[model samples]
Target: MKGFFSLPGERLFHVATLSALGFLLLFFVGIISSLATYTDWRQFFSILFSKEILFAIRLTLFTSTMATIISMVFAVPAAYAISKTNFRGKNIVDTILDLPIVISPIALGAALFVFFNTSLGRALEGNLMRFVFEVPGIVLAQFTIISALAVRLLKATFDSINPRYERVGRTLGYTKIKVFFKVTLPLARNGLIAASILTWARAVGEFGATVTVAGAMKMKTETLPIAIFLNLAQAEVERAIAVVFVLVAIAVIALVILRRFTSRRQTS
Candidate 1:
């Protein structure tokens, strides 16, 4: 313990911090473990593998993956620009971009719901495609909610990279675009991976905005979080518990993957 925590503090500091950490961990774990009381061990697998649950899992994965892809497409360029450039109104632009993250998901969803009723939104939907209470709306909601978070994460990554590396690339007669692809991107790979995993995980767990925009229509717009809501609403406690475990499993898998990537990046 002495070797592990070598700061300018007494041994009591270690005990105090570790105690706080343990308390928090146990508090959360205890809450989750209590769900076992509602869970039927015999029916757990059957409930988890049921069509409704499977559909929710598939929909959750699909929406989260699509949203993540779209977000990274926008966030990478946006993060790069914000991190590497200085311009008039840059601070304002950054603040505006970050609004989606700071705003409540429920409010975001409500905003979306209101947008579709506007004349322009109505025309867009009428001429383009329907979005009100639809599958695409779920993707849109998740995208709006998490894209800003991705930008912030990737921006920090880009910020940490030495500008000297990019300058060196330029001195080698490389174009700006080519240098970005060859140098900056490779340097930011870990950050990009981390942002994608975190955003996707967040999308998987999004319920407030998703439900508000997409509505929990069981087999249709029912992602895992939505499925849990639906099950609990219908008084299906055991099924809800089963869905909880499934969500926990997904979150665990994502965290494990993120941890592995971080470890590999650190070692490399």
Candidate 2:
């Protein structure tokens, strides 16, 4: 009697899992099907090679890469400090670090826009590079939104690393900086790579902040996501779909590379 009940429960669990997976698979299949509906190879190739899209591709790649690299430069050290040290108001600091992830990107962008009106922001704007409705705004928006994610991912990576290795290096007469570069960082290399891939993907796909800060100025501030939005708004379905495919391709490539790297790291 007990075995019979257990068998039914197990079957129910399996069916539930399969149903959830089926829904996810169906969603992606629907997107791919819609993309495939534009079977006109000529139209597809024309849109793909269009100068606007080519420029968007270049800008998206450049800003996203720059944001990820800049984020990692700060994230690595911040993550290590957050993971390895204990200080006053640490919880507050952690919450502040996570503010970008918690808040909506559009709201964050709006906040940034409002900030620029302040005295300090205005002073910085006058002396430093202009950001409002500019190319630099794209980078700033991406960096603001993506850096938090980078820090969060790296903190997890640093947490997983054994602290004893750092202590071992210190005992061998290495300074904290030396120990971190030699011991902690080498072990966290795979995590860093994975974080960079994820950060770049997030940056590339960021629309709300980018749109709000940079203003979708077609050939000027337009990124792939913004381009899709602009095309869709103008009822250019084929062009929008083509751009969507490009975004999907980039995302799939990044995910595939990250997965292979993670698998190799685990095996090694």
Candidate 3:
């Protein structure tokens, strides 16, 4: 009679939502407890301030920022093209762009490694770029993984923008390129910021691909995640967990900044 137990359904929905929130709270508490176990403040500071860890932190931030910039450079055009056009093999193109997201990062890195062994790759390595087991390899690996995700995010942003606005700009004698710059991009500013934040965060945390292509060599190719791995391999659990906490802190700060930026944009 009355919509098939609507009140009970609403109660069930609330229960499910509360249970999910409780699980998330448990997850955070578990991480906090694990970090709390390493309360040797002196030892933690020593590990955190050590030269190797400092180098790793610097390298991670630099490479991630570079990768994020490179990803956006390509992602913006790719996303807009995909969102605004219907082309032959459009679905195929989209899938290929998304392959990095779908494929394992390890496999992607392996493919890069294999590519460098090929004739063209060897030519590029000999002349222009040397990616395998080098600093460039780290950037390339991070870029490869992050760009796909950036494209996905940017495409959603572009898709959210109304086509009629561009049409109106055209009727006002603005070209497509002009309209894109003057109207669409301004409208999508918040989305662009969000995408950049997400891409940078993912790039900073990337490990499998970077390790495979860059080969984690102490202060040379050691990113934060690789530093954690190397430390754990040597039974330096405290150092490893300290790096983990550093990464957690970085993520928390980035998320807080993103939330504030989004909130301000919404209010404005």
The TM-scores of all predictions, comma-separated, are: 0.94, 0.96, 0.94
Cα-lDDT of candidate 1: 0.92
Q: In candidate 3, how many clashes are counted? A: 0
For each predicted model, how many residue pairs clash, with residues at least 3 apart or on different chains? Answer: 0, 0, 0
Query: What are the Cα lDDT values of the candidates?
Result: 0.92, 0.92, 0.92
Q: What's the C-alpha lDDT at position 40 in model 2?
A: 67
Question: What's the lDDT for candidate 2?
Answer: 0.92
lDDT of 1 by residue, 79-169 (tens): 9999999999999999998899899999999999999999999998899988878999999999989999999999998998999999999
TM for candidate 1 is 0.94
RMSD of each: 3.3, 1.6, 1.8
Model 3 off-target regions past 4 Å?
1-9, 264-268
Tens digits of lDDT, candidate 3, 57-124: 99999999999999999999899999999999999999999899999999999999999899999999
